[model samples]
Target chain A: MKFLEPGLIALDVEAADGAAAIRAAGQLLVDAGAAESRYIDAMVASFEEKGPYFVLAPQIALPHAKPEDGVKEASVSLVRLREPVVFGHAKNDPVALVFALGASSSEEHITMLRKLTTLLNNPAHVQQLKDAPTPEAIGQLLEATTN
Target chain B: MKIICVCGLGQGTSLILRMNVENVLKDLGVSADVDHMDVSSASGTQADYIITNNELAQSLQGHAAKIVIVNNYFDLEEIKSSLQEVL
Candidate 1:
């Protein structure tokens, strides 16, 4: 469904809390023409209620909100933190990659999640993603997943 | 027929797990219907079992379905074995 567009990359962010992470990701989504400006609040609220859901996976976070929460399009915003921010999960590791996802519906979004989960489960791929410094590099890494 | 409801906090991951489960079942020649439910709205449903991760499965404490903890929803091998046990 072409959610992660060419412009959905925010190189380095300096977010201290979950709310700040949502703001940074929301801005990227808005800039990418994926979501409206109002989606920032919805994303924040969703995170507040359910948290980042990082689970046992350290250094990675999947930030998403419901479809009815002002999603203009299905898209993903890739954020690399300059430093790590703790989201109070059991893993207690700083988040390096925050993938802000916005989907049109639950079913449609699952396809993307399946692909993303496969990528995340690979330690080598996750390490490459963390080491990638430029947006273009991150795009290349994502492209490799399809191969 | 055995039913397995796959759910996450939102419906996205749950739906993905449901699709994968269905595909795995089809390949195994198993007869079952997999359903997708949001973790928040999964109460009061009747299913043979619930297949989800540890966190989401904990939320379905009062459900009628037997909870089967799936470490990774995309792990076809794990999901297939778990479903076979339940069936």
Candidate 2:
């Protein structure tokens, strides 16, 4: 699975809350032809229904709904927030990085996540992601780390 | 031991948790059949332990399987310690 495509990343973006963050992140997927426009709202609705489960870790969120919701292909989007937004997660709240995933199948989702597990499970990589200054830096980090 | 990883959609986060849990289990040399499922499918399924996020854990109360709530799906240390409790 491909990481954040060129132009699919937004750095220092502004989001009022988790929903807005999700929308901003999901729009990247839509704009890249990875998902339909409805996929964005579906992700927000999923968050509203499931609470903060989308907040995967501290300062990180993987907002996604089901594939049937509107995903056209498997892709990922990254948004580094200028200001953190609360997702109501007690342990992993006030997210600064939103990773909106669009996977068209469970197999594709797992393949993408397996690579992410290697990237996200490491604290050093997590810190690099948090401290990344630009989208290109984030892209470089992912390229070097995940595979 | 049988383990079930559940999320609302059954595919996204739960699958990530399952992957981490599997790694933790491997590291501990513990053998188990770990499965991932949707919240609705989880109701009918039975396992030695049910691992999920806090919100889904609430709805899974009174289940036959012991419930394990994990705050961060990517935290293997947290997962290992949590599994150590019941295993």
Worst 10 residues of 1 chain A by lDDT: A50-59
Clashing pairs in 2: none
Cα lDDT tens digits, model 2, B1-87, are: 889999888878888999999999999999899999888899899788999988678889889999998988888999999989988
Report the C-alpha displacement of residue A93, candidate 1, in angstroms: 4.5
Candidate with top lDDT is 2
Which predicted model would earn the best DockQ?
2
Backbone collisions counted per model: 0, 0
Error of 2 at A121 (Å): 0.5
Q: Compared with the true structure, what per-residue lDDT tens digits does model 1 show for residues B1-87? A: 656555445445565567777877898898776677767666756777777766556677888778886655445777788877866
What does candidate 1 score on TM?
0.79
Error of 1 at A115 (Å): 3.8
Per-residue lDDT for A1-147 in model 1, tens only? 545555787767888876787689788888877778777887787667765453325676666667777887777777788888887655435777787877677455656776777676567887887788787887787788843
> Best candidate, TM-score-wise?
2
Query: What local lDDT does model 1 show for residue B32?
Result: 78
